[model samples]
Target chain A: MIEIPYNVKPRQETGLYNAKLGIWLFLASEVMLFGGLFSAYVLLRVGSPVWPPGGEAQLNIPLATINTFNLILSSWTIVKSWIALKENDFKGFKTYMGITLLCSLIFLVIKYFEYSAKLHHGIFPSTDNFYGIYFTLTGLHGLHVIGGLIVNFYLWGPGKKMWKSEPERFTNRVEVSGLYWHFVDLVWIFLFPTLYLL
Target chain B: MSSQNLEHHKSIYLKVLLALFVLTVLTVAVSFFDFGSITLAILIGLTIAFIKGFLVAGNFMHLLDEVKPIYWLLALTVVFFFVLFFMPMLWEMNLVTVE
Candidate 1:
């Protein structure tokens, strides 16, 4: 059975409260996951005659810039939600989380528009080396964003009872999710320049 | 730090986020002004991106408050990243046939 204690900070136990450590380890693996793809991309860029290929830059930098802003805003909303939870403001937590989730959806919508525009222009994975890596990397990142939405959904459940009573653990959960969300954004920080600007 | 101290910390986190946003825009603006070298532009942008990653990891991810062992874990993880990210590049560069 899980131990529940009141008026006390949980000690650094071996297994139960090890979620933070476990998540970090998982993110480390994720770094490797993206790292391999990025390495392949760099190798391909070195070999390709033209960087973007097919006589088209194909990346709408301005739209992507706006999406970048939306992602950053989402990160801020996540932090705000965690802060609210720490302050024991359940309503604030729910409100901020709702905004965060909305931003995530907005990001996906913008991504869909961007991808559809590319598709309409006939840019696709098999088009060339650039498009191949482009879709692979961004597509994987998009899946992560969707996964984050599912996590946020559970957190935002109306009947969720753990959040109010176990505020510390709840806040930790938010922080962990935020860590992952920030990582996705961090990857894009580098990707935007390499894929879009360069 | 008092009970209210965490609020101050949170504000600092907000400021870091704002700084990241500004730096990102700055990177985009700078991209338009061709620095005469594509490599230079990429270098500047990547440097800023690295800084942004640090802020995100150390502040938002709560790695700053983590103990020493966690830092070691992170460092070891990065060693693996360097290995995986660069080894292929090196191999590919060496294999490129000269005309």
Candidate 2:
């Protein structure tokens, strides 16, 4: 059997483990993905005569504000969970991880209500350019949140077994996942202002 | 990482979390008032959002302590991102007039 290095420390030359390097590469590409959409947003808004065309299509800012805080709180809790794992406190890790998962659900529930309200009023992606961009951007972000939730759910559930077999690797896994979660939250940090506020 | 270093980072994370929450409130509060121009409002809102992002990425994501290659990767991404963002401005200049 060929031995695969799952928990290799930082290399002497690049100073990064394999997974760390891999995640960074993945995030770099993710940056370009969101960056392209943001560029399109700028172009579309700039080309339009009236920003957010159609005066009746208003976003629910208060609900979005609550969702923003929910994501931010989740980001904090995810990190706290990672720290708990680092400190060898499995119970604390589970508690924080559970809170993080709850926040994700709260955010998605609020988003569902917001989407339904807009759709109930006959507002949708095809309604206008603003709605088009609004639905595209927020919907994509919501998908990312869902992705994070799935990974987090696994880590909080069956994935806990890895901690016993390879403790350091488990901690590293938590750290990497936490990094991705923070990135998702960071995207929303910008998205909220771009869509809801401005 | 040593326990001491972890403890220090833990404190920093807490501080960053507090800063992010405060910035969120500030962004919402500032949005309530008219800033005279939509462009100005955007500038202010994006500025706050940028600061919040910096705190989260730097502290929470541990980008501040990341290795050199990661920084290089992000720097390259930023360059391309800015190019993509500014491409529209170039089109608006009408440098190549369409007959």
Q: Which candidate's lDDT is highest? A: 2
User: How would you encode candidate 1's per-residue C-alpha lDDT over B1-99 as one tens digit per residue?
Assistant: 135657666878779889989988987887788789978988888887788778777777666666665677779988998988788776666854457
Residue-wise C-alpha lDDT for candidate 2, range B20-84, written one tens digit per residue: 88999999999998989989999999999999999989888888777789899999989988887
Give candidate 2's error at residue A38 in angstroms: 0.6
Interface RMSD of each: 2.2, 1.0
The number of the candidate with the highest TM-score is 2
lDDT of each: 0.80, 0.88
**For model 2, what is the error of residue A151's alpha carbon versus the real structure, in angstroms, after optimal superposition?**
0.6
| TM-score of candidate 1 on Cα atoms, chains taken together | 0.90
Residue A148 Cα positional deviation in candidate 1, in Å, after optimal superposition: 0.4
Q: What is the per-residue lDDT of model 2 for residues A1-198, given as tens digits with 9 covering 90 to 100?
A: 986664557677888777888888888888888888898888888888888778645889999999988999999999999999888999999999999999999999999999999999898899988899889999999999999999999999999899999888888888888989999998899999898878
Worst 10 residues of 1 chain B by lDDT: B1-10
